[model samples]
Target: MNKQFIVNLPVRQLDKSKAFFSALGFSFKAEFTNENAAFMIVVEDCIYAMLTTEPFFQSLTGKPVARATEANEVVLCLSCESREEVDSLIAKAAAAGARIPHPAEDHGFMYDQGFEDIDGHLWNLVWTESQA
Candidate 1:
């Protein structure tokens, strides 16, 4: 059986968030979209970024949403093919107006970079020897 994953994130404006991610090369599954949320496909792994309004998200969890800018409860990590691939993606994100966390890390064994999406959702794009 194939496994699938969907990471739900709270957004202030669904349309804006959808556009932002679309610019980053993620396409939405219209069948899973609604006024309250959208299911954006990240890769063929059945990964979906479920963007829901803040109010609707709050309904799912009573606790206050962690400001993804200050800190993130979840770090959406993805593996890349090479160090160059990692660098290219980070550069593209910066061009898209995303903020890169200071102090990029690189060791022989691993390479990882962090960025904050427009709505402050943190995503970690990483590449490791094994993944490469």
Candidate 2:
């Protein structure tokens, strides 16, 4: 059987968040999406990101949602097929209103870059020589 992975994040504005990710070339699963949450398809059916309203998220976790802008919450890393793919994804993220925290890094064997989304969530895109 194929394994699936999911990550949940809190967002202030569901519509805007969906729009932002949509602009970055992501699609949502309608069956798992609604007014309070959006199931973002990160890698077809294998990987998903559940973007939930802050209130809904708080209800689920019964804790204060992290202020990702001012504090560190989590850093999500995704693997890419090539260095150019990483750069390309970053460009799309920038155009979609995400913040590019820093420039890409090359470590001979690894290349990586990251961006902060509209809700201040950090997403790292990485590529490795071994992946090629």
Candidate 3:
């Protein structure tokens, strides 16, 4: 059996969320995009993030959407090819209005940095050395 991962996140506005992620070099699937939500293609068809309006998201989950600014949800992490790539991606996110929540940490074998998106979703960019 084949399986894929799709993360659902609530956004106050679809267009704004689309733009924010686009600026960070993400693209959406036109077939899954509508006025209320967008299927952000995180890694082609293997991974995706469904950015949906609060009301729509709430309906699907049968619960009130958590105010991203006031509550902790889940942190999304992405692997990068190199430490430079991690820094570069975080820099782009920051330039696109994301807030850097903390400084980048270098642990000799791994480097990690974090940023909060426009909707207050925390994302960690990491680059790790291959074990010998």
lDDT of 2 by residue, 3-120 (tens): 9999999999999999999988899999999999999999986999999999999999899999899898889999999999999999999998999999999998999999999999
Error of 3 at 83 (Å): 0.9
TM-score of each: 0.86, 0.95, 0.95
Candidate 1 vs candidate 3, lDDT winner: 3
- Stretch of 10 with least lDDT, candidate 3: 1-10
Q: Which candidate is the best by lDDT?
A: 2
Write down the lDDT that model 1 would get: 0.83
Q: Which ten residues in a row have the lowest lDDT in candidate 2?
A: 123-132
Clashing pairs in 3: none
Q: Count of backbone clashes for each model?
A: 0, 0, 0
| Cα misplacement distance, residue 123 of candidate 3 (Å) | 0.5
Question: What are the lDDT figures for the candidates, one per model?
Answer: 0.83, 0.94, 0.91
Worst 10 residues of 1 by lDDT: 123-132
Backbone clash tally (model 2): 0
